[model samples]
Target: MKKHGVISFGEAFIDYISKDRSNTKFTQLLGGATVNVIAGTRRLGIPSYYLCRLGVDESSLFVEKELAREKVKTEYCVRTPSKKICRVYVYLNEQGERTFHSYINPTPDEWLLESELQRDLFENAKIFYFGSGTLFHETARGTTDRALKYAKESGLLRAFDTNIRLKRWESDEQCRETILSILQEVDLVKMAEEELLFVTETSSLEAGLEKLSGLKIPFLLVTRGSKGTYAIRSGSGIFVPAVKVNAIDTTGAGDAFMAAILFGFHEKGIPENLSQLEKYTQFANEIAALSTTEIGALTALTNLQEKVQIFKWF
Candidate 1:
């Protein structure tokens, strides 16, 4: 079989988002950095697969159903009674920025083990994507490492999104250390401006880029919300301004951006030049901006197919 689509491995949980700044009502939505990427890619008409262990809880059931509804293949997902899907209370401010207020995690250690990963999934995927959400735990980290090794051996393009949630990690230092360790292994990396600063322990984006330059990441993206995204290749960078929109919830914008880039890579190939990289980043910024026009991350992606058609790159 020909290698196709994207395979993502990480946490998939429920985001209980506040309806307003008043915090009176909440809405349940399917979310998680990696989940959003997989669903986002599938929404953009790419074949997508999710690899993780899910519990038999209500939230886990919701995640499974939502993934199925999105046409994301979940045949590789493991189901066990010991796993408990994490629930995050997302509080949005007046500006529609979200903060992970609290977590309801009954089984943090329960994760798909390294041995559970099926190598054929990596072999058949065009790109393998993941995030930092599950790396805080030892078992998941091991599994992620194993999956990365499989992806590399299979010659699949590997992508990492440093969707850092400080509250989930034991400490900022640990988060920075864990992420930096994995940088050299991935072909592409996407991070927010603040995450770039945090991971590099630098005060400015230039300094952070300088630090990451040492790792020689093939493609680097720094997303500055409302401002634009910076796409860096071979020490050179270009800023792609975001498409203006009436933002509702800024959540999953980065994932949407990642999905677009990965979608481009899946359809085309790794951008071989700066101009090609800019085109991909420009399209990604449009997708990211559009995702915030609705409340939920996945909810905003319903019209992504149209965007893909408009931004068709052949």
Candidate 2:
């Protein structure tokens, strides 16, 4: 079999989900921004690898099991009992929307240094995925930079998603600068509607799109929940409508979208024109819509293989 070519480097943590229908009592679930994306890729039949650390604690162990179940290549996963896994307390509203309150600060993932990243994996990957969570701290920021540097030197395609959590950033200015810096280097970017406003410092969608044109990223995918995605690739623009579904838990919908998009890129090279982008974006939208029909990120993904058989790519 051929080796997987997609690798994601970032934190992975346990989420204590509020089980109460009213959002009170809690239950545990695997939750990490980047991990969810990696899992989505694997579910979409894209061979992927996860690069991060985990301890022997129960939470860490749970993550280990989940990754194995997801079949993401874990050769780059480091094990150490010295640092415990990070934790996030997730509260879900009646609408199935969630708010995250994290605990166990400064956990093992924050300590992921450059030396820990696998140079060979970085060198071999066709596409490298990243989230903004690690850029908040100095240690991890330096570590992420090294991995990004490795990907760049190796000439691998780099993708970034502005999965911003205000609580994780040091300051608004710091968040803007760090994200923009990475944005400058990546071949593609995925941003939510609000993220587009913040990153472009614009109040309206049209203005934001105009500002993004300056970056000249080969592909800038701006996802508008329910409204669909806007793709700006090398100045050409295409809008793909969102697929409607009964959203139960939207926790990892964006990750699903990111995974599906990156998977499409892994399978097909960069879109040659708007028509090509529209086809891929439509398929990705369906992938993301199906993810929300269930409570967990990877829960509803078992059907992707079946869905792929029916949906032809253009």
Candidate 3:
């Protein structure tokens, strides 16, 4: 068998999205930043794998079934009775920007342990991707650390997305420290402009990049919604403008952008120069813009596959 594709590990949950600002009616859909990345990659014809500990609840079942339907391999996912699938309430404002209202978490401490990670999966994958969702807890943090170690040892490319949800962490300082701890280990990292500022403890984007320049990260992406994404490779930066779209919901746009970047890596390997990086960022921006034309994260991705030839665009 050939060693290929991406392996993602993190939280899997259900998102209850409000119909409007009224907050009266909501539609339940599969969500979680890491889940969106894995599913999005699969939708774009990348062989993807999801690794997480799932409970026996109906929500967990929904996540598993949906991942299966999306053709994402889940053989590495663990099943237990104690784990509870998390639920997040999302409210969309008039501008299609989403605000996470609240979270319903029954087992915040129950997470996949480091010992339970299957090493073979890392050995068989070309890229290993993750986000900040699961790093606040001890068990999940350990698992993430171990997984990264395995990925490095196996010579697999490591990618990190600063999908920061401040509500999940104890404090802003803790979130910054925890996320920065692993920056030196990853080959690629993606962050929104605000996230860049928050993590770097700087007020401006230029200051954030200057702070981040001290680190050895090979590739850094700073996404600035409509203005575009700034791709930083070996300290130099290039701003790639986003494709204009009437975004209906911007919930999973970042994950879509990430999935596109990972797909490019899986198919074409890491960008050799700044020009290649810019092309990849442009393709990612197109996908991200298209994703916002629908409601939910995964929902938007599914609609994108039907409306556009996703694989051909790359």
Instruction: Give one clash count per candidate, in the order shown.
Output: 0, 0, 0
How many Å off is the CA of 96 in candidate 1?
9.9
Pick the winner on lDDT between candidates 1 and 3: 1
Q: Model 1: residues >4 Å from true position, as ranges? A: 19-25, 91-100
Local distance difference test, each candidate: 0.88, 0.82, 0.88
Model 2 Cα lDDT, one tens digit per residue, 243-311: 999988676889988888887788877788877777778888988999899888878888677766654
38 Cα displacement, candidate 1 (Å): 0.8
Candidate 3 structure quality by residue, lDDT tens digits, 128-244: 999998788888888899999999999899999998989879999999998888788899999999999999989999999999898969999999999999998898889999999
Ordered from best to worst lDDT, the candidate numbers read 1, 3, 2
**Which 10-residue window in model 1 sums to the lowest lDDT?**
305-314
- The prediction achieving the highest TM-score against the true structure is 1
Task: For candidate 1, write residues 84-120 as lDDT tens digits.
Answer: 8888897878787777688898888889999999988
Clash-forming residue pairs, model 1 = none
Q: What lDDT is reached at residue 86 by model 2?
A: 78
Query: By summed lDDT, which 10 consecutive residues of candidate 2 come out lowest?
Result: 101-110
The numbered model that scores best in lDDT is: 1
Whole-structure CA lDDT of model 1: 0.88
